[model samples]
Target: MKRRKFIGLLGGAAASWPLAARAQQTRMPAIGFLRSSSSAPSQFLATALREGLKEQGFVEGQNVQIEYRYAEDEKERLRNLATDLLARPLAVIVADTIAAIQIKAAATTVPLIFASGGDPVAAGLVTSLNRPGGNVTGVVFFATLLGAKRLELLRRAVPNAAMIGVLTSRTSPNVEAERGDIEAAALALGQQLTVVDVNGEDEFDTAFVTFIRSGARALLIGSGTLLTTNRARIIALAARHALPAVYPHREGALDGGMMSYGASVADAYRQAGIYAGRILKGEKAADLPVMRSSKFEFVLNLRTTKALGIDIPPTLLALTDEVIE
Candidate 1:
């Protein structure tokens, strides 16, 4: 009887070992997604992020978990959201726009991946592009630097416009840099530039009125998640004021803006996601080289141009990657 009992106990222990090991192996690591904009306009970007992680063998709710937090375009709310994400069991933090700054400040031990439209190095998110040399690394869209290019595109679309109005987000970290680049470009093109700094949706109407009163003939929208979140209103205001406008993303052109030229925002998010997955897979954030967006697309809306009574030049139209009828 004693011998039989000993053999039974040994078998039970052997069976439990594999069960415990399996449980430990299957434990899901949580990834936190922190964004400065609302989730409504970011759904497509979220899907792109998921696809990137899948490429790295991290499937949400399968081998990994995701914690999502959004600031809803309220800059004041970002810190709170970041703190909330930090409180969770996060193995890596995937952030975008201004949230990168907040996350970088809060979580030093946790790896951070960001999709920043601004200059990441200038914003102090990383040490350098080639060697990030810290806990933060991801894709930089160089959206602020593209201000000059976007201005040139607008000028081409409205060559006769003597003055152009720039709608800028005061809360954006890259606002000053973008404004400076746009100003330089405008001066080089021999055009007068009027800039209006706005922080919220409530200020759009007043800013548009001011631009119109200033005799600004065309509009140039700056790059920021907040501005993109409120894109429909900006496009509508431009149409109502009879202002030809250039935007920073293809979606803006699809939403009735006159023209757009910049890096693909969705692709940037996907790269960020890929970096997050790599970090979760035991790769150090400091080891990952910072990535720049490889895809840039120019888009034009023919219907918007027709409604504004402006004829798009064949040269500009030919340069567009996509045209919305």
Candidate 2:
């Protein structure tokens, strides 16, 4: 009887071993991924980040866990969402530019990594890019700085468009600076520009109307989370209005916009993921220098050009990095 009892006890212990191992796996380090835009539109960016993490040997679900939260273009919800993320037992927090600002404002002590489109110093996220000097560091793609380049590309595509319309977001932190850049570029190119600001999606129709009434012949979509989140709608509107438009990211061209000139947003997110992995591997966020995105893409859509009946200048076509049919 005693031998039978010992055998049963050993069997019971063996049966519980797998559950113990699973419980330990469940306790693996988790990363908090916060974005200020909608998830569906930015899924590719998330995948890019995961790819970066994988490069650092931190595959999600197998070794590390990633908790993703998106505010869906609602800026007001960012802080609360960030706070909720903070409530989790996370190893690191990775956020987009706007979401980083809100999370920093909440005074989080977690290791924070940001994928920013604007200047990190100007946004008060870091003291300097080289040495962040705090629990914050990530990537800066400088998308806002490419406004003039986008304007130039649009002008090249629509050489006869004298009155160019600009659609800018009023709520973006870098709005005024981007507007100033576009205006200065337009002035230098000897082009008349009509600038219209939209605060929400409801105002898009009105803004388009204002642009048309102002005799604007082309459109320059400004850089911001708001504009990027609603890119499809804006592209549809541009097509409906028969406006030759230039966008700030390649995703815009891929989605049927006329053209786009900007740094790779996916690469920036991937770099941010690398930073997160580094931090997870015992590197300090403050010690990691901010990475500047070096990959820029000039994408043009032939379908959009045909729809708008614009002839692509051969010189511009030669300079394009990617052409969509």
lDDT of each: 0.89, 0.89
| TM-score of predicted structure 2 | 0.92
| lDDT for each residue of candidate 2 in 1-325, tens digit (9 for 90 to 100) | 9999999999999999999999976787999999888888889889999999988999999889999999987867887799898888888998888898888887557999998888889999999999998899989888889888888888888888879999998867788888999898878878899999888778999999999999999999988888888899999999999998998888999999999998888888888888888988999998999999888999999999998899998999999999998
Q: Looking at model 1, which ten-residue stretch has the lowest summed lDDT?
A: 68-77
Model 1 alpha-carbon drift over 4 Å, by segment: 1-24
lDDT, candidate 1, equals 0.89
What C-alpha lDDT, on a 0 to 100 scale, does residue 149 get in candidate 1? Answer: 91
In candidate 2 the C-alpha lDDT for residue 223 amounts to 82
